[model samples]
Target: MAPKITVIGTGYLGATHAAAMAELGFEVLGLDVVPEKIEMLAAGRVPMYEPGLEELLARHVAGLPGSTGRLRFTMDFAEVAEFGDVHFVCVNTPQKHNEYACDMSYVDAAFDSLAPLLTRPALVVGKSTVPVGSADRLARRLAELAPAGGDVELAWNPEFLREGFAVQDTLHPDRIVVGVREAGGSAEKLLREVYATPVAEGSPLVVTDFPTAELVKTAANSFLATKISFINAMAEVCEAAGGDVVKLAEAIGHDERIGAKFLRAGIGFGGGCLPKDIRAFMARAGELGADQALTFLREVDSINMRRRGHMVELAREAVGGSFLGKRVAVLGATFKPDSDDVRDSPALNVAGQVHLQGGQVTVYDPKGMDNARQVFPTLAYAASAAAAVAGADVVLHLTEWREFRELDPAELAGTVSVPLILDGRNALDAERWRAAGWTYRAMGRPRA
Candidate 1:
C-alpha cells in the first residue's frame, strides 16, 4: 500500500508538492499555519500565481467536481500526525533581516509543532533549501522531541523546483535525491517507495548522506549565480571595448563545458532563491571556518546587483541624463517571466530605483502585477504592455516574458512619446524593434 503523505507549510513549495503527490495517486493531507492558505488551497485555489498549479489542485483537491478526492488541507498538527505515514516539511527559510544568515524560524517552527505530536513512527522529509548542517541538527532534535524517538526518522530531500515549471518539474523530476542516515534502512525504503513512480520513470535516484543533500540546492544556486554574473561581467568589458556581449556569450556558450544555460547577460538574477541561498551559504561557510572558500560569491553578488544600477543609468541616459520630468515605462515587474513572485526581483528593484530618482515610472507584468504592487505600491502599474509604455520617454524591459517578446513593436512605436527601448533581459528581437522605428539598446551591444 502507498504511504499516506502530509505536507507542512503550504506555500509555493509545499502547495505544489502536495498537489503533485496527490497526482501520483497518494492520499495526501496538506497543513499550513495560516488558516487563509488552508482555506484557499482546500478550495483548490492558489494564493500565488504558478502556472498549472491551480488546475492541478482543482483536479485532485477533495470536494471539487470530478476530483480524485485524494487531497485535503488543514491547519492542525495532531490531525496531520495521525493521518500521514510520511510527512514532508516544506516550510520556507528566508534570509535574516539585514543579515546574510538564513532565517530558519519557519522550518524550526514547523518541526517543533509536528515532532511533539508524532506519537507513531513516521518519516519526516525536509524539502526546504536551508544552510548546510541543518538536516543533521534537525534530525537529532526531531529524535529528542518526538515520543516515537528512534522510530520517527528524519531525512533531507531538498527541492529543485523552478518557479514557472514547478508542476512539470515536480511530476517529472529530472532527478530524485534522498539523504538518509542508514542507506538501506526503512527511511530510505520508504522514500524509494514514495518516489518509486518517478524513479521508475527514469529520474535517477541519488542516495547520499545529509550534508551532501543539503548542499546540493545552495551549491546549484551559487553556481548559477556565478554563471549569470560571469556573463554580466563580460557584458561590462564588452561595453568598454565596443564588443557585443550577446555574440560573445554565444561564442563562449558553444563550448559544451560552459553550455548556453544562464548565459543571457541582463539585469541579473533575483527571486526568492538565488540571492538568499547564496548569501546563507556564504554565512554558513563562515560559521564552519571555510568562509574563504565561498568568498568569491560576494563579488558574484556585487556584479549581479550592479547590473540593476546599470540598467537604471542606461534608462536615465535614454531620457537625456535626468529623470526629473521623464515618464519611464518598465515592461516587466517580476524577476523572471511566467511567475508572480516578486521577492528580491531585479525588475522591481530597477523600477523602484527609477521611481526613487524622480522618474514617473509605470510598470506592467502579465502575472506579477499584484505581487509587484504589494512590494512596490508606490510605482504605477498598468494593465498591459501598451498601457505601460504609453507616452513614456523610455521603456525598460527588465523581465523576459514571452508576452513581451511577442508584442507588436510597430504598434508600441506609435504609443510612446519617444520610441526608445532598453532590453534588460537581452531576449528581444533587435531587427523587429529597429524596423518598427524604435531605438533598441541592450547591455554589451554596440549602439544603433
Candidate 2:
C-alpha cells in the first residue's frame, strides 16, 4: 500500500507538495495554522498567483466536483499525526529582520507542535531550507517528543521548487535528494517508494548525510545568485566604458563552458529565494567560523542592490536630474513575471525608491497589483500599461513580463507627455521603441 502523506504548513511549498503527492496517486492531507489559507485551499483555490497550481489542486482536493477525492485539509496537528504515515514539513524560514540570519522560529514551531502528536510509527520529513546541522537537532527533538519513541524517524528532504515553475518542478523534479541518519532506515525506504515514480522516470535520487543535503540547497541558490550578479557586474563596467552588455552576453554565452543560463545583465535578481538564501548562507558560514571563505558574496549582494539604485538614478536623469514633479510610469512590480510574490521584488524596490524620491510613480503589473499595493500603499497604481503611461514624463520597464514585451510601442508613445523611456531589465526592443518616436535608453548601452 502507498504511504499516506500529510503536508504541514500550506503556504507555497506545502500547498504545491500536497497537490503533487496526490497527483502521484497517494492520499494526502494538508495542514496550516491560518484558517483563511486552509479555507482557501479547501475550496481548491490558491492564495497567490502560481501558474497551474490552482488547476492541480482542483484536480485532487476532496469535496471539489470531479476531483480525485484523495487530498484533504485540516488545522489540527493531532488529526494529521493520526492520518499520515509520512509528514512533510514545508514551513517558511524567512530572513531575520535587519539581519543576514534565517529565522528558524516557523520551522521550530512546526516540529514542536507536530512531534508530540506522533503516537504511532511514522516518518517525519523536513522539506524546509534551514541552517546546516538542523536535521540533527530536529531528529533529537523528534525522539524526545514522540510517545512512539523509536518507532518514529526523521528525514531531511529540502525543496528546490522555483516560484514560476513550481508545479512542474514538484511533479517531475530535476533531482530528488534525501538525507537520512540511518543508512537503511524505514524513513529512507518510505521516501524512496514515495518518489519511485519520478526516479523511475529519470530523476536522479541522491541519498546522503543530513548536513550535505542541507548545504546542497543553499549552495545551489548561492551559485545561481552569483551567476546573475557576475553579469550585472559586467554591465557596470560596460556602462563606464560605453559598451553594450547585451551583445557582450551573447558573445560570451556561445562558450560551452560558461553556459548561458543566468547570464542576463539587467536590474539583477530579487525574489523570495535567491536574495534571502544567499544572505542566510553567509550568516551560517559566519556562525561556523568560515566567514572569510564567503566574503565575495557580500560584493555579489552589493552589485545586485546597486542595480536598483542605478535604475532609479537613470530614471531621474531621464527626467532632468530630479524626480520632483516628474510623472513616472513603471511597468512591472513583481520581481519576475508569472509570479505575484512581491517580497524583496526588484521591480517594486525600484518603484518604491522612485516614489520615495518624489517621482509621481504610477505602477502597473499584470498580476502583482494587490501585493505591490500592500507593499507600497503610497505609490500610485494604474489599471493598465496604457493608463500608467498616460501623461507620464518617463516610463520605466523594470520586470520583464511577456505582456509588457508584446505591448505596441507606437501606441504607448502617443500616451506619454514626453516619449522618453528607460528599460531597467534590458528586455525591451530598443529599435522598436525608437522607431515609435520614443527615446529608448538602457543601462550598458550607448544612447543613439
The superposed Cα distance between candidate 1 and the true structure at residue 366, in angstroms, equals: 0.5
Q: Model 1, range 1-448, lDDT digits (tens) per residue? A: 8899999989999999999999999999999988888899988999999999999999999999999999999888999999999999999899999999999999999999999999998999999998889999999999889999999998999899999999999999988889999899899999999998998999998999999999988998999999999999999999999999999999999999999989999999999999999999999999999999999999999999999999999998889999999999998888788899999999999999999999999999999998888888999999999999999999999999999999999999999999999999999999999999999999989998
lDDT (tens digit, per residue) of candidate 2 on 1-448: 9999999999999999999999999999999999999999999999999999999999999999999999999999999999999999999999999999999999999999999999999999999999998999999999999999989998999898998999999989999999998767788899999999999999998998999999999999999899899999999899899998888888999999888778888898998888999999999999999999899999999999999999998889888999999999999999989999998998899999988898899999999999999999999999999999999999999989999989999998888899998998888889998999999998788888
For candidate 2, the 10 contiguous residues with the lowest summed lDDT are 180-189
Note each model's CA RMSD in angstroms. Answer: 0.7, 1.0
For candidate 2, give the lDDT of residue 38. 94
Per-candidate count of clashing residue pairs (backbone under 3 Å): 0, 0
In model 1, the Cα lDDT at residue 387 comes to: 95
